[model samples]
Target chain A: MEHLLTEDLLCNQLQHSTKQLYRTGMVAQISLAISKPVSQQFACTLRVGEVGVLLAPSGAGKTSLFNAIAGINQASGFLKIGEHDTEQIELATYKRNIAYVTQTPVLFGHLSVGALLDVVSAQQARPFDIKWALEPLKLDTILHMRTLSLSGGQRQRLALLLAMIKGATLLLLDEVLTGQDPSTKLACITVIKTYLKRNQAAALIACHQLEDALALADIAFLQQQRAGIKQWQVMPISNGIHAYQQSLLNDCADTAQDQQTVCASAFLSVLHATTISHDPQLGLCEYRVAGQPCFSAYSPHISAKQSVLLVLRANRVAISKSLLPESSFVNQWQAKIVSIRPVSCQGEHGMLIDVTLVNQGALTTSQQDVVSVWITRLSYNQLHPKIGESWYLISKADAVSLSCLN
Target chain B: MSETDLQAIILTLQLASLTTVCLLLVCVPCAYFLARSRSVVKPFIETIVTLPLVLPPTVMGYYFLVLFSPNDGLGLWLRNVLGIELVFSFSGIWLVSMIYSLPFTFRPLQSAFEQLPKDLHHAAALLGFSPMKQFHLVILPAIKPALFAATTLSFAHTIGEFGAILMIGGNIPGETQVLSLALFDHVESFNSQAAEQLALLMLIFSFVVVFACQWWQTQSSQNGYVVNNHVEGL
Candidate 1:
């Protein structure tokens, strides 16, 4: 909530600049008749250092929007940088200021990483550090490797570097980085976030990762239907970002007090495994969401190839910096803290730490993986966990339970 | 090889070289248009361009002969006004070879142009690559195998020409008599040894061309590039 207010204040501070050059050098305008006419008309004013996220599935008009903004597709729209619309300006010439890293990266096949960087770097009028760009991507050692030979993640990082070196004012990234390790994802996100903040630039990241959307986005442009027509509505995620997760809200309820649904903190999301294996000796049903924390529950009804949503009590889930080896706990998953707030559990001061599961398959039908891990205020202070810091979510296998979903 | 046969082979190489270079210059843009344009005449244009692949060479030659005969109005106008002649000359064979082997070039180039994902073009545009620059940097390299196949096939096809060049640009010594015509003359004259030697050369050239094309396609595909980033399009 505090972050959202600061964001509003930040926007207001940068709003009244016309004559004096502003921090965010240019203001981008997207007014047009799109291919997906009604669906693509999402608008909001963004300042430098402000990041907006477009949360939608693939094939949901995300790339269409990116194409329209980049002036690649034949759409009737005004793409303006600063006061003059780009359409009125030289629209036919390739506009170097717009950096669009598509999901399927199209790189110059023959050029090595160092050569690509050197070429794009020479085109820039402003100063840019190639080492700084390569630092977060961890691509310094692979400078001689050809762009065509790089992996998907490597291509994404290189695209970002080229964008930075070329000085793109409005960075439009289409889920370029995915399937990275927890630390790597954080590093990539930090690189982008810091670049935007320092340059006084704005970005719109199209992502399916909730943590990415929540952690970096000042505003969430969501897909919704109004009067049977699809449109975009800007939902400010400054305060209570988790409440924006649809499943966390009870459809039957209407109040902010009931915003966190009854089942919100109850279920844990397991993305990959189709079947759950039962350990007879421990009497536990084990399922693994690949690259995410594992879950084990004492149940017999859950069978192989079953998609079951395990029930996790708020108190049973524990957060720690390291694995709790002393306790007989087996179910553990790595997650990063999103937000922490004071709450009263059993008439005691407790911290409701919101931890989001980190992975490419972090998406869920319901806000299941992102649940509250209740810890006493003393433990929270002693551990000193902050937002974006990784921590383990653990529960004793014997204490866990599961309910099968049809 | 005799002096006459040597002259014929030299003329054939010159014609094939000129035709291949000119045809590629025309086909690259035509194939690009065929792959991407949505104009109303696109279907008609595509059919006309690809006709040489399926049409009999003699039938195609017959049409060209009728169209470009100096007696015809359009042919006479080009000759008198532009100082250009297209019938019974080296220039005529060059033009005829270009038309007859067009499909050999256009089909592969067109297929390569079509095989590329549209996203790459957009990425090139955002990266500030001009149309020609985009073609050089992105489109050309990506379609190298097809380009190789198209150029070699067109050259080989023009070299082995018979029916079309014979009909439109009749075998005039030193001007239009190509290798294929010399071989025919050798065989018809019952010079079995000369015909055998010429046939062996043509056979070796065709084999090398085919082998090179196959090697290029395999090399391009196995260039250690893996793109797993699948972005769904709307």
Candidate 2:
């Protein structure tokens, strides 16, 4: 049998009808077939040790799905974890051999950090080397301290480390990086990636940071709601963030009110770029995207030739018929409008115009540097921007958010 | 104090001590079940545990007295098979005390267990601890103060028991007679001095129990032992 976890769980959000009776609040159907050792296929199935990220707005049943998979919550479904058929055998949570790190690290408070580590080491068949993470996660100094005395980030780091060391084939991490600083968050991400690769273990990490989640995930699972039912859909992320964002835009329109964050992310384009120049004195950095220069505020962390992801909000992108005199808009690109379509987002009507860089060669979908601009109904009527027309797009330096690619 | 009064005092201490031990042994499992079990009959079982708290001790003793009568089926079976005699004996009163003080010992433990971090057991299980180990290492240690509270309250409550002991054990010298019965006998015979002395001793003992429980809770809070168990729900 394949080392895989498959579930078609039906979960309900229950509310108390009176003091004793509970009425069904909402129902969600979570069906996923995740394979160990990461398989590469169409978006139909996720090859999971390559790491999958579960993305949804709050209360989309991400944690509920994790609980179901961990055998903590009972849901009616055809559930299987590796050789154990959960539907046939009532497997205990620990018996499932799945490591679950909840939002708050559930730790033994009575035990010291060292004692906790000792217990985990003694119990696990193959313990992950805590020494490898001691320095980076800053857990070395706190090893002798009691777990109850540790800060939020320290607790999260320890929890993740222990879960990895438990040597479970699957890891369910729910917002494990919430309390960490930027450097620590990067360290945790690196540590998680290293552990997964080294152990050939699959992880379904639920995080709200789209860039970080996408950077770490081979494929993304979007918990989408259609009509009254919510479902988990395998979202292909091979074409980078643009294709994924575009897919969200296309599929999440109907549920815009419930998925405000998803809709907000859909209205932005994430471009992969490399830094060309940085002037710390002037606090400005120039990046090359699709063979064009894009300028943004400087950061000490971003050096020349370092790859980065630039987030450009569609509404901030302004297009003109001709090149105009720049005031504070430091970045400008000459492009040809490829498609113009009317769209309603968050109950507001707008026109989404897709533009491609001028003079670019025949590019595949993955290589296409398409910048989407959202113009309101008033601006659409005023500009009368037509498809296949050449235009100049202007954006302020601050409008572009520079995120370092991991 | 007279020799009979001394014998009654000794017997009361022995009864309270033995009854408290038995209550702890029995109530730990009962409190654990009441705290964690989701069975359909949980409410019914909870009601039974609480019955001793609300009903008059004489009423509880009357039921047990009927149950332990030699003419009754259960009492006859015990006498025939085990050669055990419970009525008007030390064992009879000790058993009654355990039942009478059940809620005093069990309620605090149940509340503490209920207030325990919900995921503590789950965390222990995932860490490969057996269920027994989880209880010994995680659950017991977390509720140590409550354990102390339960033991002291049950001991104190058993010491104060009078009506149930009278109904079951009767007033017999050095066998089933206890301090409460001696004090009652002294007051009825117009021996005001001995009765006053026994009443004063009982008052001081009750004060000590309340002070010990309050002090234990304060110490536990100061040491952060109880604070650590109060993890916010996820």
Q: Identify the leading candidate in terms of lDDT.
A: 2
lDDT of 1 by residue, B1-234 (tens): 799889998999999999999999999988988889888998888788778877888898888888888886878888998988888988888888998888888878877777777766766667766777778866887777777788888999899999999988887879889999889888999999999999999999988987877676666666532211111100
User: Per-residue CA lDDT of candidate 2, range A1-406, in tens?
Assistant: 1112223222121112121211121111124332222211111222225567776656667777676667666644333332221231256776665778888877877677888888777766667676788788888888778787788999999998888777765677999888889899889888877776666556777887776775567656764444434555554443334555665566567563535444531465666677888888878889877677788877667877887777777888889887767567777878889988777655657788888766432333344567889887898899999998999888888888775333
The per-residue C-alpha lDDT of model 2 at residue A290 equals: 69
- DockQ, candidate 1, comes to 0.27
For candidate 2 chain B, the 10 contiguous residues with the lowest summed lDDT are B225-234
Candidate 1 has which clashing residue pairs, if any?
Answer: A274-A305, A275-A305, A293-A333
Q: Which ten residues in a row have the lowest lDDT in candidate 1 chain A?
A: A1-10
RMSD of 1: 13.5
Q: Which lDDT tens digits does candidate 1 get at residues A1-406? A: 1222222343344344432433435555444445453355544555666677776545568778777677766555345554332332237535535677777777766578998787666545664664775767888989999887888888888888777775666788888557666677767778888788666567887876655565566667766545454455566542223444432332323443542223333323223343457777866667755445455655666677675444455677888788777877786677789887665322345676777765635454333356667777888889888999988888786445443221
True contacts kept of 2: 0.42
* CA lDDT, candidate 1, residue B140: 82
Q: Which candidate number would show the highest DockQ if scored against the true structure? A: 2
